[model samples]
Target chain A: MSATRVTTPVQSVDAQAEWELAYRSSKLRDCEFTTLSGTPLKPLYGPDDAPIDPARDLGLPGAFPYTRGVHPTMYRGRLWTMRQFAGFGSAKQTNERFKFLLEHGQTGLSTAFDFPTLMGYDSDHEYARGEVGQVGVAISSLEDMQTLFDGIPLGEVSTSMTINGPAPILLAFYIACGERQGVSPKDLRGTVQNDILKEYQAQHAWLVPVEPALRMITDVMGHCAKHVPQWNTISISGYHIREAGSTAAQELAFTLANGMEYVRRGQAAGLDVDQFGPRLSFFFDSHLDFFEEVAKFRAARRIWARKMRDVFGAKDPRSWMLRFHTQTAGVSLTAQQPENNIVRTAFEALAAVLGGTQSLHTNSMDETLALPTEKAVKIALRTQQVIAEEIEVAHVADPLAGSYFVEAQTNRLEQEAETYFKEIEKRGGVVAATEAGWIQREIHRSAVQYQRALEQGTKRVVGVNCYQEDEGKGPQIEILRIDPNVEREQHARLTALKKRRDAAKAKKALDDVRDACSGKDNLLERFIAAAHADCTLGEIADVLRERFGKYKEPRIL
Target chain B: MNDQKIRVLVAKPGLDGHDRGAKTVASVLRDHGMEVIYTGLHQTPEMIAEAAQQEDVDVVGLSILSGAHMSLFPRVRDELVKRGLGDVLLIGGGIIPGDDVTKLESQGFAKLFGPGTNTEEIAKYVIAEMARRRAATGGRR
Candidate 1:
């Protein structure tokens, strides 16, 4: 050891100097806080930051351990579908919006059924009253389905229906409508949000108990796996979980737990993972945290991949690839300074894109105020376009690849989510947690925390809390106001459709649904047959509810 | 004067299904001493009123956000009058339009609060309004 002690020139720069140069005039920055799930984020990250195995964790895209992106050339080959979720009033009105969106260069379609249809009420039913078409399209029967897809070629467009509980009935009607259009069930390419676990956890839209609801979900999964192989049977959604004020990590943990439960149910039904798992997809909410949302998606992909491969023994790569659809977080939209929502949406949309989403729906600026108007919706869609075409974001895959902050966050999120997964498993998985209201309590705790933060000004929402303007508030953004007359029109259509359909045939089909639901027979097949016979959604639901009995949530506060 | 019971109808108007706040509010209100009639989830305005009338409530609270509250709340207000229950105070909450708050109030909405509103204020408002209504109606007959 020659004690050379050669004094080398000061290496490059000190940490503070580098930070100042990198972040621009940063004082000795304050200590950064950990994520909600206690994931520490360093003030910086670099190539050697992530504690991930190169061969095991950072696998190539379209291969095992997909970290770069899901597909080889995600946007270079084809952009994610720009599916604007539009529906209100009646099927006729929603059909018009669908046609309009298509004419405006929208690729895929998403239908938002109203509460009545979601809860399985026909428009003519007494429970429907003011809710028939307030939130989304009203589908009382197969006739409404026909009208919804009228003029819009169902064979050409892939439609995603955001309905659960009654998802099977709606899917049945969709298949029947497609049959009338000269299309076979095997040719249909679309998705049904048949995930009921999230409903129990975050949304509370359960129409039946856990066992029966799972039965209905398995029915859809088995039917789609066998018949409509091109369709995604379920979209395990974390969007509502996040929207319900859950942290990004909670959304990931809870959603994956729900997805795993569904997979277990599907496997219990004797479907091979390779056969049914490929059709399993996900839906997520891209929130305001740019890097956090991106990391959430990456962490989600890794989690799902590992679970499918190691836990579920899914051999097929396609089964491991967690294909997901993302929507900008609606809760992140601000009612104050609404235009700021446009910027927020742009960043959220970018996060989704960079997160390797297969499909995305950006919320319009005015969504916080009302249903997005046509102008605002166009702008929202254009936000995605500008990012894809103008911003050159689509050119590179995982643009934030190897970034210090993102990598650390990704690792942290993965760890936190793994812990949550274990806890859920210990709690007897999703069903047990939901039944015991554990998941719900967790969501409530997180929501209360987030709300308290907003109330206490710990988190600054630009126009909502900070920078409050008293007079001459920002430009009044035009909100989409659904015409009230549409209700009367839909009611009239319901009356006419009820009068015109074959009463005896409808009654018989409903009887079949009831009989199938009451027994162990696959309700999907029976529901499909009933849909062909023009049995309205309400009629079918009435029969199922009469047998299944609705879920009365235990008082859990 | 005797303490008047604060009547509240927690409802979900649109397709959004997060009812933790609604249920939590109902429980807290009950604990804070209010007669809360939770309409459960996915309740339309008609169901809300049917519950309101059947329960003989004094105030109706609407929790909606799926961007349908603008059209949905007005319809609820009109139906409340149609059922001859217009005296019931209509309060709107959840993610509502700020400008539309005045519009809804002008259309006979008593109060409007978005997220982050103090639950105590809500409870106190309901109690005070019920007391005022009882006084106005000459001790609820």
Candidate 2:
């Protein structure tokens, strides 16, 4: 194997002597200086590091195998959408926050749901007693969803909802809200994080079992293809995977593996490749590792484009694009010196832009302390603006494309991801691997290793491991406090809505949804009908839970 | 031999679903010679209290990030008290504000670990609390 490949010897004796002299004179920290994944880095990179045929490997942007970018002009034509993720308290409260963001020059709206809503429960559910309007906004019924986007024109604004377990019902609620606003389904454009495979692997917010979940996702794909043509039915996500502790290469490989699984399932469901493929999108995490994240994004686009065009035989060029939204790493934020997180988020957001993200969400500085206040959210939005208007990094497409270090890192990431794909294939695909606990174990191992490094002082997190600060001496920042009355108000509103809605019609619609779950009918239409009948989210989820059953995650540790 | 193990029930109360902190803490506790039982995500207060009783854990750690600590933590504490397991140490972590931490401690929580808390500090607190409880109970274990 070694004889078959070309080898380059280190022939720069003068450079080596210079490096040794500097190394001997300088006093360095007693820790390993490497990438986030422990990949050793050299002081300098040269042509030998990434020997590439530019014509073959480094193609132009918007061409086949789009390694540089998916668009011809990238950010020069139109800036990447400055979508700020905002939500908290009740629908009315979050609606105010949404309007505030839009007024402050936010280009798009990305919603964050409260815990009960994310877990597919109503505010009044016994299990959802204490957690109604915390973390994010609470949307239980069509009424809540309507109020959540009351004045915002659905046709004019693009919205992204980050909910997974009950994504279909939430999407239905959103469509119903749009229709009430006189916006046709075809005019509505947005994304729903309907990526359940990642839920089982990392995020743990899944509804039914694996087969039923995939079936429902395929149903959404087909349903949107015919009716909601502009809607992105699924945002296959790697954000949660990276936040859960996977490395850059693992995030790229596992996310693309999940994306391919969705593609295969769509094909198996008899949908044309181009019909549903164009609407497929992705979500990733921009962590503290700058070059590694940029490389991960570049490698993701190239691998996805090749697989879609060659392996899957996608004919449309739009089907080959791998557009993604990025949110700065929430796990990277610290509570000790909370203001330091502002600098961290700015760096991560800049890396996401340089890597050519279509949309971005910069996490608020106080997130590690609590949900972000309005003031903190505005600062976070300004971070993105400074990168776009002031920094001027988006003036060129793939600005670091030809750099020796970045190109080499991108190529190395691609090779590592390909190796992961082979390993996953040997374990019988992503779904099988997840079920067998292989994928979860891999993420767990990486997480443990990273945490161990942090504990052992190998990694330096400012204000955490190195910069010691007394508890009372740190800067005092105001934290957002969710009103305790929010839950009571939400419960009352849910009660009023339930009483006013025609019980027989809602019950019949829910029964229809349950019937569809048992048969081969697409569940999206039934779910929309149930949404029209004013069925609560928990009601819809409970109907399916009776037939398909909930998913019990396998123990990986 | 069974008494030598410091059994701990680690649970996520409510619907946060971000388990990096919980799992990492579980691993750290296990590494520190404690038997950790992780109950996974979206566990209600009732489920957590019941697990603490069934596992007979020396400590109950509730990891909440949804800012529902004021409501959820008290429920877990009251549930354990109702079950006559008030002697079991109750601890919490994850994104809780300083004011709420003071209130939670006042409500009988042994410790409220916030973000950036060192894992060694948590292990030390748990071990010391268990030893203190054993001494008070006449070393029943």
Candidate 3:
């Protein structure tokens, strides 16, 4: 409508006094001025509000304590990977989807397993009843893994698996699958959501107790650093934490603490920080809070760099860089008006790019009702493509770096995260604090508070709170339904595989897995053997569970 | 007429770990003066029925987000029938679609709320239903 209206820089004190005088007489809308988390906000932030010393705190891109960004050229050098999480039904179904995504210009692959597989149950297990390949693909053994990536060349593409409880088994399956395709372990590239502490803190998927789980993580990190050099052994994630309803600051604080705990554990297990550290990556959620989410990402990099350098004493610069993958907030999607979620995802993805993430996944609009249809997933992907091609935001690194609002929010988040760190330390460590339900209670408090605000009309969520939509009046979206036949087919396939595989080899492999759990041998090394011997995921996980024991979560309000 | 407090057991009856809605609903129901018992996570259908019988709960609310409702919800309702807790109202909420919600409602599920449902509405509905059921049944044992 109009060209930019430029303004001259004014003195901080004089401008504030003038603004304050006008604000007293001027009428304002009756609304809250705080952040989504209820953090108090200033009307207008100036240079004085941002007390950051750019030299020390905001170094140039690719420099020490990379608050600006991890790369010098940023997206100019390479655009952030557009990797969408995809899976459902059998491995055959998901494999077709994988090739479909790759053909459509998706840069990387992120796999989602079904609830039964995520919880380490086979299709035939009693606990797996009614849950085979409902949420994601069911990969019960090496045979399924091979079929899942049948035509795809592992040496060329990087895969990210969203598996935690049974991460080692899945990783071994991938390695064995790669070998079948003539890809060596050294040539393999990808990451696993191997951060187990968060399983207790938020995402409640785990096979063994905390102590044994932590041990398995250390074993994976140690083995991967030497063998699969390009593989990121762990993606310490805050995505599930935020999805579980933690505030932006809590998500940042808890995730960094988990990362530090891994470093501590790896060190204690006689592993070099520089060796495993460079491959350590992060995954975060890009929530609806625009400035808060951006600042959370910026502060995350700064806090992680400082922790890696000063606290852990890692000399390698790569080890200090906090590389992360982000996914848009799924909880923010309103099922009442499903189409509005596309706009929500677009804004959240922009925040991630501006905040400088290495990769991103935008949730489909129809995700809240069920797994997304093909059209929904495609639109979600195209949202990112348009942002990258249509918008000019990608040209600049840390584009919002100098804005007083962004810097202030970033500084405040860094300080808030530090306060949580001290509290977590006071309770021994991340494990002890999580075990005691302190972290969960904090998350619950935030979640309940948000709910209260939404109910009270203090927080306006378009379809839910403010703009009312009559029931059955809005357009209905077609949802993808999981075939009931998927379960029976999976069961038959598992039974047939069990019938054909050598019984002695499978049993011996499982016995070795059990021994590895009790003895000093690396568990992943034994897992690879089990994968070679055609051992099922449940077969190996069952042995590990028996040896390592099960974890019973402490109830939290 | 005797006054009987509304007792609701908010159970997570599947492998899904999404308890945010369940926990928030439990907290909200308690604020509205209802006795709320939450069966934390990863409870099977049989375990849910057993918990309801042990707690003698008036209502059982299951929250499942893993898309297993078609297979799981019926089994829970059946288990309740087997345990003689058939009078217990069964309701749920999750990522369930419209067709499935209609189908579930026909199968004895009192009402199933989906995402973006107001907790206040749930509380008010529970209270009203408890009153209507209590009046029709004469009195509780």
Arrange candidates, best lDDT first: 3, 2, 1
Best candidate per TM-score, number?
3
Best by DockQ: 3
True C-alpha contacts between chains kept, each model in order: 0.30, 0.70, 0.74
Q: Which stretches of candidate 2 lie over 4 Å from their true place?
A: A1-28, A473-475, B1-3
Cα lDDT of model 1 by residue, A51-133, tens digit:
55655665777777777778988789999999989888778878888888888889999998887788787766665565667
DockQ of each: 0.31, 0.67, 0.73
* Candidate with better lDDT, 1 vs 2: 2
As for TM-score, the candidate ahead, 1 or 3, is 3
Clashes of each: 2, 0, 0
For A1-557, candidate 2 gives per-residue lDDT tens digits of: 11111134555989878888998899987779799888999877866677665555657788867887988899889999999988889999999999999999999999989888887889888877777778789899999999999899999999999988899999999999899899999999999999999999998887889999999999999999999999999999999999999998999999999999999999999999999999999999999999999988988988899899999999999999899999999989988788899999999999999999999999998888778888999999999999999987988999888777888899899999999999999999999999987998898889989988888888889999989688772338987878888888988998999899999999999999989988989899999999999999999999888888988878866
- Pairs with backbone N, CA or C atoms under 3 Å apart (clashes), candidate 1: A45-A404, A122-A538
What DockQ number belongs to candidate 3? 0.73
Interface RMSD of 1: 3.8
Stretches off by above 4 angstroms in model 3 are: A1-12, A473-475
Residue pairs whose backbone atoms clash in candidate 2: none
Candidate 3 local lDDT, A286-393, one digit each (tens)? 988899999999999999999999999999999999999999999999998889999999999999999999999999999998898989999999999999999988
TM-score of 2: 0.96
| Per-model lDDT | 0.80, 0.89, 0.91
**lDDT per residue as tens, model 3, B72-123:** 9999999999999888878899888888899999999999999999999999
